[model samples]
Target: MSGKPKLHYFNGRGRMEPIRWLLAAAGVEFEESYLEKKEDLTKLQKDGSLLFQQVPMVEIDGMKLVQTRAIANYIATKIDMYVEGMFDLNELLMMYVIQPADKKEEYFANMMDKAENRYFPAFEKVLKDHGKDFLVGNQLSRADVQLLEVILMAEEYNPSILAKFPLLQSFKARISNIPTIKKFLQPGSQRKPRTTEEDVARAMKIFRS
Candidate 1:
């Protein structure tokens, strides 16, 4: 809040993961100031600090940025961490990752009792149909990181859902094991929930059978 950016969140991995990773990848210093779910937004309202009157806010050098993608992209730009062609690739993958969840919310949430549409085959097609690694290809872009998280989420939450897209499987496997990504895999960096080894092990057990 003083000089570098400070993140506000509900302690669970929400919109802040990618933003935090981007900041870390860029080697920028940030504060991960977590908040409880019941924490009052009144303090933010009183101070007129929450720009969009929302949680998951990021305060950078005294400026408040609201919404996850906005903050994530802004920080990526600030640190020049976005890979070449990252903007375009992010747009494509963003649509791929979000569209199905919006279109089939009841099927994804109510029927399944889950918060994600990870089972949607169309979602996997986004990457598979494109037939490219690293979202845009080769270089480690923000889109790569974001898609990597989504792939892990889909596999963990829905199970066997991503296998339909063998291309996606290969692509994800290659990037997930990238030296840079592997190096960043230290406990010091932020992580997406489904990315845990335990979840992956569970999924692999099911897939093996």
Candidate 2:
């Protein structure tokens, strides 16, 4: 609210990544408190900082927001439908990212097939049908920010994923070039890098233990 929002989550991106994306896209600077160890989470729970005793929480507007959808809604008041769709895509990608190393290849293939055939085409059509740079109205919205995040995640797996979709390619280019988003995309920015095997293992140890 008055001061910069503080985010509480793991160092790597999970649900909080999209919230970071939205805030960055809006040009809002925030701080992060990463849960690096089990005690870090246990402390929060003991202190009652977590309403649901779970994370992806945000301290904004003098309130502690939990639940990914609720936090996203608070950040981006409108544009639920598109945000939900993009988040659905994000979850699919997350599933692949955290898969076992031996099973990653198969999961990656299945996830790509769904993304290319089902998800990407739907968003591509929304852009083409509207003939606008953003998925919703002429200006950027939460939908646009979330979609851009999803597109980048997809491209990390396949650099040429957008080759078949010219509109999405242009959309990604347009969104990435925005001054705030451009800054966030830079190296060393708060934006987390693609999750790695070590990151996944660490997260599992923290949450599953």
Candidate 3:
């Protein structure tokens, strides 16, 4: 790797927050490069700097890694925070729910069924069986950090949404209490997710294309 890793993304959290959380949890120093306008993206795409014409790119080891999940996975692996051989049910469910609006109705219906009948129960079982504070093993992993963001966003919509999932609520509380993560929550440490319905609608329109 270079002297320090570099991340490129928009000023908004978008897909970069999870990568930020992973870096913070690992106690790694890094640099951020934020794009300000559509022209910035276009310019990057015109060159080969942006492979997919997207932000959330990470520059490390003289290479640029594209895609949010891929970059997060790479960082998690570098810091040894990734849980090997484990598929995160919550993450899978989230991917399904947050897909493009064209098929969102169908995907959301499937997500609800999986969440109620399979995903949540499996997560609860893992917690009860392992008696651990985190989702995977005893220690916090990228999965936990990623899940915390999701839970936080959900709570924005309904404050008591997690009440039905006591184990998940407890897990979220535990992770939020971590010193690094607690510091991350302080005002201005990070950008808040774009929450307005119009902002979300516009974002979805771009995403669907």
Measured against the true structure, the TM-scores of the candidates, in listed sequence, are 0.59, 0.96, 0.73
Error of 1 at 35 (Å): 1.2
Model 3 TM-score relative to the real fold: 0.73
- Top lDDT: which candidate number? 2
| Rank ordering of all candidates by lDDT, starting from the highest | 2, 3, 1
- Alpha-carbon lDDT, every model: 0.55, 0.89, 0.66
What's the lDDT of the predicted structure labeled candidate 1? Answer: 0.55
- With a 3 Å backbone cut-off (N, CA, C), the pairs that clash in candidate 1 are none
Better of 1 and 2 by TM-score: 2
What number of clashing residue pairs does each candidate have, in the order they appear? 0, 1, 0
Q: Write the per-residue lDDT of candidate 3 for residues 12-84, one digit (tens) a residue.
A: 5566767787887776767887665566666677889878877778888788899877787777753332232
lDDT of 1 by residue, 109-166 (tens): 4423322243334335556665656445456666666556655554554577554567
> What's the CA error at residue 146 for candidate 1, in Å?
1.0
Better of 1 and 2 by lDDT: 2
